[model samples]
Target chain A: MAAHNTVATSNARKQVAAGGWLWGAVRRNGAGYLFLAPWLIGFFCLTLGPALVSLYLSFTNYDLLTTPEFVGMQNYVRMATADPKFIASIRVTLLYVALSVPLKLAFALAVAMVLNRGMRGLPFYRAIFYLPSLLGTSVAIAVLWRQLFAADGMVNSLLAQFGVEGPSWISNPNYSLYTLVVLSVWQFGSPMIIFLAGLRQIPVDMYEAASLDGASPARQFFRITLPLLSPVIFFNVVIQTIEAFKAFTPAFIISGGSGGPINSTLFYTLYLYQEAFSYFRMGYASALAWVLVVLIAVFTAFSFLTTKYWVHYDD
Target chain B: MTDAVHEVPGRASTHPRLTGTVRHVLLIAISFVMIYPILWMLSGSLRPADELFGGDAGLMPSQVTLQAYSDGWFGLQVTFGRFFANSLIIAVLATVGNVLAASLVAFAFARLKFSGQKFWFALMLGTLMLPYHVTLIPQYVMFRSLGWVNTWWPLILPKYFAVDAFFIFLMVQFFRGIPRELDDAARMDGCSPWRIYRKIILPLSMPVLATAAIFSFIWTWEDFFGPLIYISEMSQYTVQLGLRSFIDSSGTSSWNELFAMSLLSLVPIFLIFLFFQRLLIEGIATTGMKR
Candidate 1:
């Protein structure tokens, strides 16, 4: 764009640089693509190529020990009709995502609102709250989560002080998914920080005007804060939803990689891993992967579709 | 509780000071819940076996000792020293690879006019949402076929090709914020596009590059699944896999030792976060999504 004022069109100039032919056009962006070569190689060989291969693999019966044998949709059909574990993993993942995202976002926004009140030691509190999200997904943290949710672990010990007995959180099927949800909500720092940034962007005068009009704090939140903060909320929802869908390590580590307690903690990625590697069901895993992609695509489509009804951007 | 105190009959108050006090107290309590587990680990790592499972969930150990630290460091066959070097090597290389490749590609995306720009950008972003498991087996097979399994190559190479689209996207957002006037000025002085990028754009981007570097190092250091699937040799394990091995070998008896090593594993990332906190937080905050 440096030469933009001198030339009417940079594209025409770029075309002319390599002698004005289709080959010239191809050669023109060579430097740009050269800068992009690593990503381009990765995009093809790593992402899109394997993505297509996985799609093909989904339709075949391939164990790592043998060359893929064409199966023609049997994997998907089995997943839909016969594979109980696959169905269980999907149910677990949906429940986890549905429960975790809203809870995390709500906790995040509430704390963000509190931190936005100009308290002392703002950075200190923000950092402390954010510390969990930083380390939450680590194998160590997941292992600690296992211990914390054990029958005689700290969670139950604390519950005992209140004169109440607690169930074994991780080993109990009815309670296992909820423990993961609590873990998800515990790492509310990323969205909380983002919400803090958004909260700061909202003009002080908007609140002042509402206050002058005699709006209660709750009223002002609905009238002014919700509308202004909707875009940030939307971003957090989409990202966290995708993240919750992809959660693996906690369930893997907590369940000791068997997705047990009767498959209570069988997250989708964990199940896919078990299929591909543990059971050597590579074909089945690939099909499960594609099904997940479609599920996420539907959710993402819903997010975008619902935006017009609620999300408002002044720009 | 403080709200009731604010309703005193005689004194007229206007600062909203009472609510602020209540807010601070509530925030402090919540922050305790957020931070207590980490502190518990720190304390539990120091305590003897008898005190660890006791009903008291205090952040202070009854008997403070560095015995667990020494035991954990030397407990594994390969030693924590080996794990440390392996983690540092992988993290440093991956950081270098990601910063170089992401910056170059980000420059092209942000500054240069290219064909199919929209499609390529979308493709890169689309990769961000792509479940890594979709590409997991094929990549494993590809790397295994190349004889790179059980080594660092599979873990570190894709990073060189900007496989982590998040870093490139972050850098692109940073590069976009640089004024085009700077590029124009550099060009007027007979600079080529590469020279302009090197002289002007690169100088203005240290914060973002640092942000990317810190994130890369932490993530690579913390990565478990990549090494779990690829690196199987005992001597080649990173710190994360080493910690997992600790648990696998002695499930319940080595709680104090596991806690000690886990805390030690977190130190590198914690220190990096401590030093570069502002850049990383502001990077994510200002990196197009929030703004």
Candidate 2:
């Protein structure tokens, strides 16, 4: 038993002596890697592997059934020079991001401000507002949207009662995209919730002091509210812009997955899905996908770059 | 929040600027618009078919019927029950996969002093912004080759490997909030790191875990795109897919029955939202910290 103990001690000392810092780290941090194994495996195999494969696939002329053949810059060239629907999709998405983000933010802030005033049944009111965000992108909601905007649907019925004429919102090229924009804006609960959290962080004394100084409510809002909430607003802008860029389901379902009514609602992802699945042009779709990522990255970078000008964190 | 209380101790949060009837009136009106569609849908689903489009649209249907519910039960090649089962199996398994795997990976990042931790954390964050579409076709091809297409494997299995970076980031944030003293005390007692995690970390972190589970269930339940791309078999269709199959907007769709089934599909998420709104809202609020 003593000999066994001495052997064990000697082995431990040898392990301590061996490989110096590397082995020490391996022993110390091995559990971390073990814990991280699932994520690491996923990071490499699912995310990085697929990402790299798509990058390579973007340069190939692969259909789903055929082996991808190297085609260099052909896909990129076609996307930039040949695809009009591509340009239209980009335009629609950009217009969407431009219109929806500000409106949604404005609407969300307005509601959040009202709710912030210690309303009765605050939780219930908050829940009612938030219900749209939860249901906004669901298949049910999309279906409901299609019907509600149809010429004979409830919206038109409501308009008839008001003695105003309404177009078939989904089928009219002019109004098709705006219908989606409204739906997107309607889900403003997310940002509203976040805004509420940000509002909670603001010191109410600032408002009280400003009021005591005879500053108008508008003056206090401009001086105090906007600056303090800028970071949260920035957060909302970045997230919503990215979300707008990726808007797919409502367009897919409502516009019948073809982004019809003159391609006005052809969100980028919807078009990409068709290119890959419908046409089986996986390579072209891959190129479109890369362009989307680059577009999002550029916008995100732009937001971050401009944030210092507007988002005051030091207060 | 403290300042709000300090300034208006008498009435917790009422703003002095906004007062009485007018504010409530405007709020009630806007609230009506916000909630109108759902109320309309609930009523529409319950209404008789002829009454659906006629007269003023109101929640009061002259006469209601259960016909839509029964017919929509097996309206397609499969039944709504099958779709519900499919969704339930996928969601429950996914919730389990996400909660366990995310918490495990989170434990590594939050507690263990590992090399390349910051790099990996940033990489994880990068994945949060990486839209699933960029990875969609390639994953489809991969899963197609592996014979995972039409099976729930493609939708369900990646979750087991902690592929959802959002959930991991959430869990990481949560694990960081847990005190380290329990870990230290456990280590001093000659407990393995795994023991520290399983015995101490898991028990105390129930609220965050509950948040993750609740979210995973709802998101998976509502997930339209993943299943849309992956599964084509009617037998394998999730609730969203089943609901979509009922919709042929340009064709003959049983609108009343579709509404009934849609309402049925919504019940789980609505229930989840109703019961767990506080946790869900708080979880999302903290996660909005990520951006």
Best by TM-score: 2
Q: What is candidate 2's CA lDDT for residue B39? A: 82
Model 2 lDDT tens row, A1-315: 999999999999888787676778899879989999999999999999999899999999989997999999999999889999999999999999999999999999988887785667778878888878877677988887887888778888888888877888899999999999989988988889999988888898888788766688788788899999999999999998998898888999888788998999999999999999899999989999999999999999999999989998965
TM-score for each prediction? 0.93, 0.93
- Please, what are the lDDT tens digits per residue for candidate 1 over residues B92-199? 999999999899889989988779888899989888888788888888878888989899998898999999999999999889989999988887898877887788
- The parts of candidate 2 lying over 4 Å away from their true place are A1-22, B1-18, B52-55, B249-253, B289-291
lDDT of each: 0.86, 0.86
DockQ scores for all predicted structures: 0.48, 0.50
> Where does candidate 1 chain A have its weakest 10-residue lDDT segment?
A18-27
In model 2, what lDDT does residue A14 have? Answer: 82
**Which residue segments of model 1 deviate by more than 4 Å?**
A1-27, B1-15, B288-291
